[model samples]
Target: MKKENNTNKKAVCIMSGGMDSTLSAYMMKNQGYEVIAVHFNYDQRTQAKELACFENICESLHVKQKYILDLDFFKQLGASALTDTNIEVPTGGVEEGVPVTYVPFRNGIFLSMAAAIAEKEGAEVISIGVVEEDSSGYPDCREEYIQAMQKAINLGTKDDTKIEIKMPLVHLKKSQIVQEALHLDVPLELTWSCYKNEDKACGVCDSCRLRLNGFKKAGVNDPIPYA
Candidate 1:
C-alpha cells in the first residue's frame, strides 16, 4: 500500500571521525555505494573535536547526505573514561583487559542507530570502523559481535530489510588499517583519534598510542598534531 522511496544502491556508515571509521566510509564509497555518513555526539571527551573532524571528512568524501545525532545519555551514565571526567583514560600502554575508555556497548548502540537509518533510507549495508586485532580489547569490536548484531538487525527490521554490517577494519591490525587508509586516499589528517585532550592529541593516550604505532609500522607519518 505504501510506496517506498528508493534510489541507487545505498549504504549507511557510522563514522566516529576517527582514522579507522573515516577509512571505512571511504571503502564503502569505493565499493560503489551511495554513502550516507552518520556521526554521533555521545558527549565523549573529544566530542567537539570529533564532530569537527566528521564534518571535514564528509566534505572530503563528497557525501551530501549526512546525519549528526547527539546522544547525551552517555554523559548521564558515565562509567567510562571517555564520558566521565573522573575516570582517567589510560596512557601508559594498551592494557591487558578492557580499558576504561571502553564505552559500555558503544558499538552495539551505534549499530542499532545505524540500522534504523539504513532501513529508512533503503540502504542495503551498514559500515562501521570497528578494529578488533591490535585494539584495546573492546568487546563490541569483535567480528562475532558485529555478525550477531547484523542478524539481530535484519530480524528486527521489516521482513524485506536485509542489512549487512560491514566491519572493514575488524580483523586488520592498526598498521594494516593505516596502510589501507593511505592506499584508499582517505583524508587521514581530517580524522582524530585522541581519547584525551582536545587541541593537540595527547599522543600517549591508548587511542593515540595505537594510531602512532600504526603509522610507525606502516612507515607513514601521521599528519595530525600531538602534544
Candidate 2:
C-alpha cells in the first residue's frame, strides 16, 4: 500500500458506488487531501455489480488507493434487505417508518472499519456520504449518531491517535448534496445507487427516486441510465 506523505492531512472515504459516496470522495479529493476509497462486499446479491461500478469510478477518478473489504461477517448476522434477497427492496419514499432496506447498523460498522484503516494509515479523518434528508429515517444516519460515533472513535482509538468522522453532507438535503457535487464536477454518471442490479436504475426504488428527485431539484440531468 502506498501511503500518503502528508501525514496530518489524509482522509479515507467510504465509497459505495452511490452518488453520495462518490461525491464525498470527490469533495475530499478536491479539498487537496490524499483520499483513499474504502468499499465493502458483504455477500449481498448486488455486491458484484456494485463492486464493479466502484472499481470503475476509482480508476476513472484516479484515486490514489482503494480497498475492497470482505464483509461476509455481516452476512452471518443478516437482518436487512440489502443482505437478504428474500426481502424485496422498497420503492418510493419511506413515508410511514424506517424502510426494510435500512441495513443493520451499516453506516456505523462501515465508519468503524474506515476509522481503523485511517488510524493505521495515519489519517485524521474518515469521510462518509450519509445525508440527513435521504437517510433521515435511518437512525444510524442521524446527526446524533455521527457525533456519538466520532466520540467513540476518538476514545477507542486513543492509543492509536485521534480520528474524526466527517459527515460533510449529513445536515444537507439530497438536492443540496447534488448541487455541491455538481459544483465539484463529480462524475455522477459513474455512481450506482439503484437497489436492483440491472443495466439501468429501477427508477422506483427509494434510492433511485431520491437520486432522480435530487438531480431534478438541482436542475441537472442525472447522467446515469434510469429505467
Candidate 3:
C-alpha cells in the first residue's frame, strides 16, 4: 500500500455497508489517511436499511465525512434485480449468465461519481472494495475494468494529477477479506450484505450466501443475524 503524504491528503472510499467495503475504509483510516465514505442510494428495496447501516458504520469509525448520493436515475434504467424489485435476487452463485443481482454498470457509475467528488475534495485516491474471488463472473469487479476506469479518471479529471484507484482486497478471497477485517478490529456487525430487507438475512441470496461461506471459510462466526 502506497502511503499518502500525511499533510492535506484525502481519500474517498466507496462504502456499501458490506464486509469488503467496510474493511477497506477501516484499513485506509488505519494508515493515517483522511477518509471520506461514499454510498449510493439506488432506491432498491433494501436501500433505506443499507443506508442506515452505512451511516452507523461511518459514524462509529469517525470518518472525516460521508456522502450518500441518490441514484434514482440509474433505477429508471432498470436492468438489474437490485433496482427492479419485480425480479428476485438470485440464490447461490451457480446460475447461468451474470447473476440477476448484478447491477448494470453500477461500479462504473459509482466510481465515476467518486472520481468527480475526489477532484472537488482534492483527494488523490479513490478506494473501492472489490474482490475478485467473490465477484466470480461480475465483469465490473475485475482488475481489467478497474484499470480502465483509472485510465478514464486520469484523462477526465481536472487535476492533471492521476487519481489512484485502490483495491486492497482485489486479489484476496472473501474469506481472507473477513480475516483481515477481523484483524483490523472492524465492526462486522454494523455492515449489511443481505438482499432481503426482513428482520434477518435471507441467507440464500448470492450476497448472503457468499458472506456466510466466507465466514465459514475464515473460521469466524458471522456476527450478523441470518434467516
Superposed model 3: Cα runs more than 4 Å off: 1-5
lDDT for each residue of candidate 1 in 1-227, tens digit (9 for 90 to 100):
12234458898999889998899888888877888999999999999999999999999988989999999989999999999999988888878888889999989899999999999999999999988888889999899999999999998999999999988888899999988888888889899999997899999998999999999999989999999
Comparing 2 and 3 by TM-score, which wins? 3
Candidate 2: the clashing residue pairs are none
lDDT of 2 at 226: 76
Give residue 169's lDDT in candidate 1 (0 to 100).
87
User: lDDT: which candidate is best?
Assistant: 1
Clashes of 3: 0
lDDT of 3 by residue, 1-227 (tens): 44445766778999988888999988887776788889999877688778888999989778767898997886898888888888877775657767777788889999999998998888888999998766646779898899999999999877566699999999998789888988888999999888876468888887887888899999989998987
| Per-residue alpha-carbon lDDT of candidate 2 for residues 1-227, written as tens digits (9 for 90 to 100) | 22234544888999988888888777777666788889999877568778988998898778777899998877787677778887888775665787777788888899999988998888888999888866638888887899999998988886759887888888787888888887877777878888876587888877888888888998888898877
1 or 2, greater by lDDT: 1
lDDT of 1 at 146: 95
What is candidate 2's TM-score against the reference?
A: 0.91
List the candidates ranked by TM-score, beginning with the highest. 1, 3, 2
lDDT of 3: 0.85
Tell me the whole-model lDDT of each prediction, alpha carbons only. Answer: 0.91, 0.82, 0.85
- Runs in model 2 with CA error above 4 Å? 1-8
Residue 2 shift from truth in candidate 1, angstroms: 37
Sorting all predicted structures by lDDT, with the top scorer first, yields 1, 3, 2
